[model samples]
Target: MTATVVVGAGISGLSAAHQLATETSDTIIVCDAAPRLGGKLHRLALDDPADLDQGPDLVDGRCGDPALPFTVDVGAESMLARRPEGLELITALGLDDHRVHPTTARAQAFLDGRITPLPPSNMGVPTDLEALGGFLSDAGLRRARAEVDHEAPALAGDVSIGSYVADRFGDEVTDRLLEPMLGGVYAGQSRRLSFEAVHPGLFAAARQGGSLLAAAQQVAAAAKRSNDQSVGSAPPVFAGLIGGVSGVITALEDDLRSRGVAIRSSTTVREIRREPGVDHGGRFTLVTGPVPAPELITADRVVLATPAAPTARLLRALAPEAATALAEIPYASMAVITFVLADAELSGSGLLVPPGELPTIKAFTYSSNKWDWIADRAAAGFGAGTAVVRASVGRFGEEQLLQVDDHELARRTLAEARAVPGWQSARPLRTRVQRWGGGLPQYLVGHRDRIQTIRSAVAAVGGIAVAGAYLDGVGLPSCIAAARRAVADL
Candidate 1:
């Protein structure tokens, strides 16, 4: 009997197994349905000429050595530095010195048919009305400013972020500001997302019956004060490993293997059932592998660290209530198109495209400009004129948009990307498109209540716990935190 069985080999599951390895001398085994261990944390290699699929000869030795491959993250590229879990994990895995932060490049937003600096805000909620002048119309700006005088009644229960923000600052603020900001994270419409779940700090303030603008200001001020009071220079908002964020997964995998933990990829946990009156070796039995001749593994404890759908399915028999709640959580699909260009010169870290403002493209990250390492590596690997750029496509409820073949999708993305100012002259050397179906979980209205119900149901089932991006947030730090909490609960 396995002492502990972790179903799912994503960052959350791996982190849980890591925690379990340190806490108990149990026979731990991690299983993932996907062929690869790192679920969304994938690192793509850009070395093979066949993978290029287009553009000039990258293998030519004129620019740099042809032997070395240029690597970049295709999934999650960076983790939040403000959250300690990601950084702490890095340090614990002896990867502290390899940590890197984004350069001091201001992000820009394409508004009103032109590019402009993104205004200061606390996650899309404009703390200062003056900053909205560049994007918001005169009347829209007045409406946002008028929020100070409006009587904000105490918020009762949960509501969509778009509904509440529009009620206070008008529809323009929701469309022009909040939509793109929230879209970048959840890839979901703000009108359908939960206010309490998305912005808890503002939600807590709103429950007290006060001006939202004032609440935003106070929150921003408190954040500034906290940063200012920190020991040395203020920490960056995000951090990535020097090689790639996927390094964390590789490191964790190695560490777990060294400790005698078993990781099984391409192995699906078809079902999990509670054993009756079995308390000696294990209490749960897991059915896995091919349906023709399934294998059973018994475990004393289990951690369900998969996405909403899979987790819900596995918990159907074990915890029906939790399964039902988990099924209610929806996910969004997206694609990231990475381009290596020759003689390209782009400014700023990236550009955000509000919904309806662009076709096929949601955002563009001038990765070579944002990360000095990418630039240095590009020059050393490809040539002095090479630049790396990533374009994000698709959003919540936009699955049909990504149905096209990779070549077609890349074509559409590249065409739209070139239309943006400063990117027109870019000559593509190579292009790769990575599609993530139902990658990000959406936090819809009443998400807080749903989470509570799921947690309550899971807690009642002895020796079982659930952890994933859907529980708290869709960030690396959040997943890590959830994993730790799940282990603690077990």
Candidate 2:
């Protein structure tokens, strides 16, 4: 029987394969270059066995009790509790009861050498100038206030989020306020990321408005109203699994195996060969395996769930135009430094570092303080006074920072952590660095148009599907949604 081949073992790939397995009787084969699954979502074992996450991590935050067990979610730690897809999948995998939420969702920002509560914002763009003045300079505040009286510049097709916000609030606000939050999500330079692609709601509001600040307020209010009207009296903002986010992947793998899908780790696809006139009876041949011992597998349909770079490489010969567009999509590398500190007393989720404030690191999270499960684990095994803090370094266009040795990088991060409040007296018991090369995709200006073009090109080729963090969003929900959509298309 002709099989369906899925390239990459990331959530996107696994989700697509799972969907196919559920919907059809076709045999599904999943391949990945890495010896292990879960891609960037991996967990590092801690001295306290209870703290180990099974896979790699995505985003970050911090906070916890001193007497708690210190565990770290080295990859993505939480999902939007409101997004039903991730929860639905987790429940379907018999992990429904594992759902957990952060003890505290409040966060702060490190600005100009001081810690300040992040201003009320609509994805980094502040809605209230008075509240944000503590972080902004007099000039920055003036520029922000001026946005209300002034009309936003006419943006034609597509514009960078930074350019659009800067035109309204000047560079200082964009650099200090908007950049940190947006940078945290995309690891992209605001000047390059598309406004429409990154903040569609705000973009739509801006298009309808006389001023950006007013538009942002409207958007925030609408979101609040929508959230208030959501099914429950109150829905959680984010959710995590009891064991860890990696548990989700583990559960998924178990479920897929039970469904008769073949998951091959350490298998990389070198190229995809599209058969001519196969739109009627089309098939794809995948050249995979390492080096000289390459193996070929033919598939009735192919779903490329890998990141843009490798996907582009594989499709270079088969779908040149789509490959070109995929190749043009830029990526950013980042490193997460998880530090175990004894007798730590930090509170709140974490601190976001604005551009130029801390060139070496982007953000930091107090793990023990943020998640109760981590706190309980630490409390149970390690007794009290143990803390786990995670900090991330590197950004788009900042490859030099990521080139340093892990030891050196950890030293630099620890040194910087000392500067932040509550971390002054704490000493690290252990430190680990996880480097994610080409981890984040930048949604640059004209990104939507480029995606449409890519979609059209791929459709013309037929029997192929693409899904990943590069398309809809960089979060788990977005990847899962995109994966399901891709499978439906096939």
**Mind giving the per-residue lDDT tens digits that candidate 1 earns over 1-490?**
3489999999999999999998888999999999989888998876544444643322232333568766899988999998889999999899998899999997898877789888888788888889889688999999998998888888778999888999999999899889888888888889999999999988887777778888888888877778768845677999998778998999999999999999999999999987887653348999997899999988889999999999999999878999999999999999998887876667899988888888868888889888988888888877786888889998899999999988778777877877788767777766778889999999999999999999999888878999999989989999999999999988
Write the residue-wise lDDT of candidate 2 on 296-403 in tens digits. 898999889999989888878767898999999999999898876765668788888987777588888878778877766765545577677789888899988888
The lDDT for every candidate, in the order shown, is: 0.87, 0.81
As a whole number from 0 to 100, the lDDT of residue 52 in candidate 1 is 41
lDDT at position 385, candidate 2: 75
> What is candidate 1's TM-score against the reference?
0.96
TM-score per candidate, in order? Answer: 0.96, 0.93
RMSD of 1: 2.2
* RMSD each, Å: 2.2, 4.4
Best by lDDT: 1
Candidate 2, residue 283: the lDDT equals 88
Q: Report backbone clashes per prediction.
A: 0, 30
- Model 1 gets an lDDT of 0.87
